[model samples]
Target: MMRSRLTNAPARLFSTAVVSAPKPAATRPSSDKGGGGGSGRDTLGRRLLSLTYAKRSAVITINKWKEEGHTVRKYELNRIVKELRKFKRYKHALEICEWMKVQEDIVLQQGDYAVHLDLISKVRGMSSAEKFFEDLPDKNKNRHACTSLLHTYVQNNESSKAEALMQKMSECGFLINTLPYNTMLSFYISNGQLDKVPQLIQDLKMNTSPDIFTYNLILTACLPQRDVETAEKTLLEIQKAEIEPDWVTYSTLTSLYIKNSLPEKAAATVKEMEKRIARKNRPAYSSLIGLHAKLGNLDEISRIWEKMKSSFVKMSDTEYACMISSLLKHEKSEEAMNLYEEWKSVSTSGNPRIPNLFLADYIKRDQMEEAENFYNKMVESDIKPCYTTWEILTWGYLKQKKSDKVLECFKKALGSVKKWIPEGRITKEVFRNLEEEGDIEAAEQLLVTIGKAGHLSTEIYNSLLRTYASANKMPLIIAERMEKDKIEMNDETKKLIELTSKMCVSEVPTCIS
Candidate 1:
């Protein structure tokens, strides 16, 4: 059953492959030895990184670089591929790797092959990546390449393939470290195969040593079940095994403590987590701010926010969003707005994520006027409002009993979303309001919008029927429309059809009195 659920899960669970291969150090081409190209020309790597994620080819760029009489070093090309992978430009990364395969001067190592296989998995799919792995020369099918394919299998939720590969790796003596085991553990946790986790951990202990990452995965598996007892035991085991508990370990424990309502333990764990925070680790700082927010430690949040601001020359939108969200959780809107302004000044792209936060706060407080103004201001500033923004506006109008505005906002929301199913509650409220007002045209328009979203249900059609019944108007095309939409008729539909059939257009009033 759990395996069934995993089978139905979507592919590409990870944006990038999870492998233990560290990036090679950056090395400039020897051509850059004399005062940076002398004509202010960019390096091959720089030109490659500058290419957009559109339908462009990295091979074309490489050819152009070679035409400029520049030497294309293998190390520089590898660095650029890594950078492209970092930015999630999988398509271009694969192109570059494919180009490297044909260059006489370029010879790919085992690690390069691993990276290539990983990129193929991301750009193409699991099947293509499997073929690439199978076609690799016998000498190139080393530990790294095998591990890379295992990552692809695990991420794609191909449990059988991953298990078979793991067995093969073990037979080949490739399971020398905890990397492959850790990958499987991650897959188990994500797939909700918790019962399999402990057994896997046991296997790791018996077959190979469990590293800190392995222990971290074990602790993470304990989270959804709120198994605090197991988490504490694992922490102790980490200490006994002499594996240093990193900030991630303590951050996770702090969350567990908070979830179990042990605030004191959480607070103490937070201190330990902070103790392990590296000066340049922004993620750790964010974790600290988030944990402090959960503990309602506003003072600690402020202290950590200041520390983070001082540590980095520039803060990312994510960092600002985290702080603003934390402040908002404590009802500190003033501080949140200030941070939003600071973000706006520095933000290059007019991302609507930060603006939606304030909009949500305003709507929650029944401040529709402020919400409308804020939405308009965001649009004026060229920030495209996402579905959440429109959904917020729709709910606000629903609360005010403005059916017209509610319909307008719902249409806008539908336009922005690619595939969205209307929530039953909001759908009920919107159609009910329109039905009560006898707005048959609005009801039909809303029905068509929802039908286009591909979520038309029996109840949704019934809402339109109810609007027809309230208006005492016969819908002549009801049967044809239901058949076209493939909605099966039920008791309610039969009753409404019978009722409308008896209502004569000559006898009924043309308009509601």
Candidate 2:
């Protein structure tokens, strides 16, 4: 249960003011200005839409209206402020907030003050929020501004201020709802002053109906209390409160059992957890599966797997991946492979980790044929292989002495990753594989694939240059290609180039010599 710092807004803002019927000078919709008495609503909307991050953007547009004897309506200014916050341009959001305070036409509401305090708390710190709150005209202190102050105290760990303000709120009857109470509960939880929790919760139960979160906090406090007995008492107390125990309560209990090495109790808690929530809870299910795996209850793991697949819950790649890992743990590789195939057939997106898990198991068994078949199947299914997937294949094929297949897997893996973030140092693995065989054709094919994908990096290109140099082939063309790609020459490039020159004269691989 989270609390918002802003007060609830009115049903509408800037209602049309009354006027004598003879003149018919009345407000209208924002779209139709209806000739003059300038409000600058149009300019506010236009400036926000421009989406410029420049300092003068919002201020300059509003100031022009101010210079010409026009001011933006309160509602229009609020809309721009909200839009800037939504775009995550907090500086502009505060700028719009500040600009609204000066406009004669914009009469700031409590909600406006609420917005300002929250923004100040967000962009600046709680110190600024306290100062702003202090400076507020006493009329602005509503439930929102007051709670925000309590939150500010909570944020900065001003325990004394928070308790005082919380006392003030309780006396003023601002604690009518559970939100403020939950905030205080969270504060106690974060600060680890849980001895104060039971008393606070007892008071909460007497004055206000404690929700599930309040009970969950009590449950969380059990582990630190160093006894499962506390959790059980808390659960009974929760049921006594007529509050239904949710998955969180059960999950916490299950975690408690796991923490104390109580597998049977943990399993019972997971079963109860499964019974409570009607829909698919992936995290809970995965946790149960993992706990069972850790206990070596293969039969239980299998039953849970079947239960998960039959349920209405859509399985994620992680769920499938975890299942694959569990099966591997239990030496059920064939079953894991079949499950991977079935999962891949209906899956909408590909996850590299799943296949990599399968590939590792295959390589460990020296089942190169199966690994090759698996790789081809993944490619045919359009599930792209990442570096780990390709690396294992490279190692497998090199072990089988098929240098071409090693480079083939390397190109496919490198070509698959289209994201702009540089891939990690798997290029070293590829260089080692190619370097051993000294196969120029494989290196040439890899360089061609790299160029087409436009994934050039110093390590990747240098790996190839080193391969050429070790094999006594001049890599002048690779240097030229690096220049064309605008990749700057690093020390590795220079060292490889100089080594290649020496190799051209000596005509032997360095490792051989």
Candidate 3:
């Protein structure tokens, strides 16, 4: 949810109604349609998730349910959209944003408009995003909207545009908060443009007091250079400003200590992280578990896991994924396997990420057999793997020079996925191997899968076509298909066609016929 700037905040459009008691024997009507113990809100969440799965239009589906007498509060819609975004279901999320735009039942707030802008930016493009901002009424074009657009530019690393936008925001008197500054500073840190950050910090201090996020960005700037001195200086500045470091601050410091090879400092920072972890702060505990794993503090990792299991808190998908990843990182494969089994037992729907952590770790370690074994088990149990999983296996097989297994995984991948961005270097290496061998059959098989998935481009198609033409057969068929797909052949593709023609001529019999 977006936050509102002060004074320009949206007006409350509705009021609660006072009611008199109906009768002594009467009970208040339950909002739940089933009149069961479950909260209507909980049911609404499940219903929304189902709607997403069924590929229904979120706005239409939800409005239909509302018309049928189901309760769909505005706040619940916010929560559902947030959750859907977290699940990477952007299609449904954008629909809800569209719904909020047209729904005239309530007054639209600055935060609402910000959410709308961000979603539209993601689904559409920069032009649409600018149009959305331009279309907003004057009152809505204050700090939140300005910052929302600023965030879009900074996120994409359009540095000149972001800076230009920030300058415009200041000129319009809409730079009323430290948030946009913090965002730009964070962007600078991300791009390793730390030198430009000092001026921004100075401006932030002069105009408004910097928040914890600003200090955290300063801390992040020290990470790439392993500048512990500068990191300590930032911490001192934070303390001087009477701002106590929160979890993010401490987490950044912990990373700083880890990177700087100061184990004791990192250990102390983990203690600080633990203090912030209330019993139900599963992510906090998860972070601590991962930190200890990094530090090789296996005992602490086990202690935290034991605490989580003993506590009354319900473990989330994030917690399980974190703990599993931590265990694998620390070489506790046997223990990780046992924990994974427990997770599977509790999670009926299964978690793909849990297995992926192990898959990725095994791949990194070059333990191809183990990675394959784990992947097979996941498939056997009906837990669907994502594209990255298949890409990793394909990459591993390519490294081992197992062309057949590489082709096998590529086939399996097409069944489960539509499009995925593979590691460019590894994919190219595989292309090179298949091309040199003139394995036209294997090359065609892969080309067809990714082609239908619509991942083919001029560069990718050229490489594959060159390989097919190397075998001196069916080059025209592939070329014709590429043309049908509306892929414009580049100069490189033209050269490959010419080379194949010469090869075909050289192979022709000299005898008259």
Candidate with the greatest TM-score versus the true structure = 1
Could you tell me every candidate's TM-score relative to the true structure? 0.81, 0.45, 0.71
| Models sorted by lDDT, best on top | 1, 3, 2
lDDT of each: 0.81, 0.70, 0.73
What is candidate 3's TM-score against the reference? 0.71
lDDT tens digits, residue span 1-513, model 3 = 122232333312100111111221112222333212255454655655555352577776777777889876677777777766666666677887787677777566788888778877877876677778877776777678778888877666677667766665655556667899889888888777889888888767766788888888888888888988988888898899999788778887898899889999998987887887776465677788888888998899889888988885467778888888888877788988898898888887666878888888887889998888988999898998876667678878887878889987776666665456555675677778788877766666666666767677787777776776767754545467778888888899888777776654332212211
Residue pairs with backbone overlap in model 2 = none
Q: Which of candidates 1 and 3 reaches a greater lDDT?
A: 1
In candidate 3, which residue ranges exceed 4 Å CA deviation?
1-129, 152-161, 191-195, 360-373, 435-513
Model 2 bad stretches (over 4 Å): 1-283, 309-321, 337-360, 374-395, 398-401, 417-422, 472-474, 477-482, 505-513
Ranking by TM-score: 1, 3, 2
Model 1 TM-score on a 0 to 1 scale: 0.81
For 95-204, candidate 1 gives per-residue lDDT tens digits of: 98999998887767889999999999998998788788767776777778889998998887778767766665665566677898999999989989899888777766
